[model samples]
Target: MIVNRRGWMGLGAALGLPVLGSHAAAAAAPRQGQMVHHVFFWLKEPGRAGDREKLIAGLKTLRAIPEIRELRVGVPAPTEQRSVVDSSYHVSELMVFDTVADQARYQDHPVHKRFVETCGDLWARVVVYDSIDV
Candidate 1:
């Protein structure tokens, strides 16, 4: 319920992957009864400016969905190295919703649909992990 990307990646690294995933965040932490939607993307070309820009802009569109309680999209950090810090992903998207129903609504939201249509081709692979606050 309180895992960050670093923690997730650490698990993945131990098993060998980029994630082992999102939870709905509270105003303070992840434990105020929220769901998490976490995504990791491996791009076709991470160095391409056009791809990065398109993906970044597309991710912003998800914020428009009213169901999202919290959202954060960003490139991997240049963090101090450890086996768990898998930096292979081009970008990571983390979101928290008030409930599973809200996350489900976000899945079908029109803005989300548009983002996939516009930029889905840019990524070679995507990994998603979702969790419910229990």
Candidate 2:
């Protein structure tokens, strides 16, 4: 069965897996940070292939930024029915950072700024989800 974050935290703690916002987080966050960034872009013109390609290309340029440990960009998966899944977004990016600081730096980096400036106009809505690894 699917479990939510609280349930995951309980399971993680029991299994000695990392849990964010616990005592360990307060004491000293692991130097190898566990910040995850999830971004979904909904295009104003979702029917247009050009908009999708442009955003994909722009996001690829973001891979050159040094702070991100891992970066993945793609469209939604054709998963089976689920209650909480959201697949309406045109483009999605999943980025993992070593720390919150590194993520913050990425937000202000010139290349990131350029990506926004260049491709921001193509989307009708943008949703971002940021989380610490637990």
Candidate 3:
């Protein structure tokens, strides 16, 4: 999902807060900077276009949440390495929240729950990696 200037400001206003100047601002206090969380999903089957659409739609809902710093979604790129082949997974999602607490809240959010309920069956495996910038 794309977040424009006005959109970000609107989100801030909705939360009764000030608008952030950069993506970094949404991640943490200026002194601490931003942290990023990367999430990967392996689908149960291949060629489920309908399910993919639903997933995207669900993600858009997540994007609307003010706590989320950034949200990126896409499929893995094809590669030539035979041993490193990944064929079952259909898509991946990376979401960055303002803080660790925000991430936790997101996990427990109703919208996130709805997304999982609606699209969880389509995935065979899921992995999440989180890191903070030093």
Candidate 4:
């Protein structure tokens, strides 16, 4: 349960899993000119696992879009509750694109459209924040 780095590497080797090197990790980090699209969903039926799972599954389908560089789907973390922290949303997603144009393409992509059509009723409120490196 308490595996050290070497032990984890050995376990990964035994499992035939590809170890992520520094390069692979760096590839996921945000780069200048890349667009970060962050979305928060407040479910109509908050605290319902089924709805949350359905929304998460729908969000995952967006990864099929070619313009998307990276996609991360998550729920709020159980971090210390502070005035600056907002964990009210039931589900959240962070998508990275090579450029703002790429993100626009993703908005029009069929997969994203389908996701919206199918899962639109699940959330009562949706908020989005988009940014780029300065």
Candidate 1, poorest ten consecutive residues by summed lDDT: 18-27
Top candidate on TM-score is 4
lDDT of 1 by residue, 51-126 (tens): 9878988998888999987889999898998997889888889999998888888888899999899999999999
lDDT of candidate 4 over 36-130, digit per residue (tens): 99999999997676998999999999989999888999999999999999999999999988899999999888999999999999999999999
lDDT of 3 at 2: 100
> How big is the positional error of residue 107 in model 4, measured in Å on the Cα after superposition?
0.5
lDDT of each: 0.85, 0.91, 0.75, 0.92
lDDT, residue 41, model 3:
75
Cα error, candidate 2, residue 124 (Å):
0.8
**List of clashing residue pairs for candidate 3:** none
In TM-score terms, candidate 2 sits at 0.74
Model 1, which residues run further than 4 Å from truth? 1-27
> TM-scores of the models, in the given order?
0.75, 0.74, 0.65, 0.78
Q: Please write out the lDDT profile of model 3 over residues 1-134, one tens digit for every residue.
A: 99988988898899999665676565754325455777777767657668767766766777866778889988767777576686555677787766788888888888888888988887788887887655
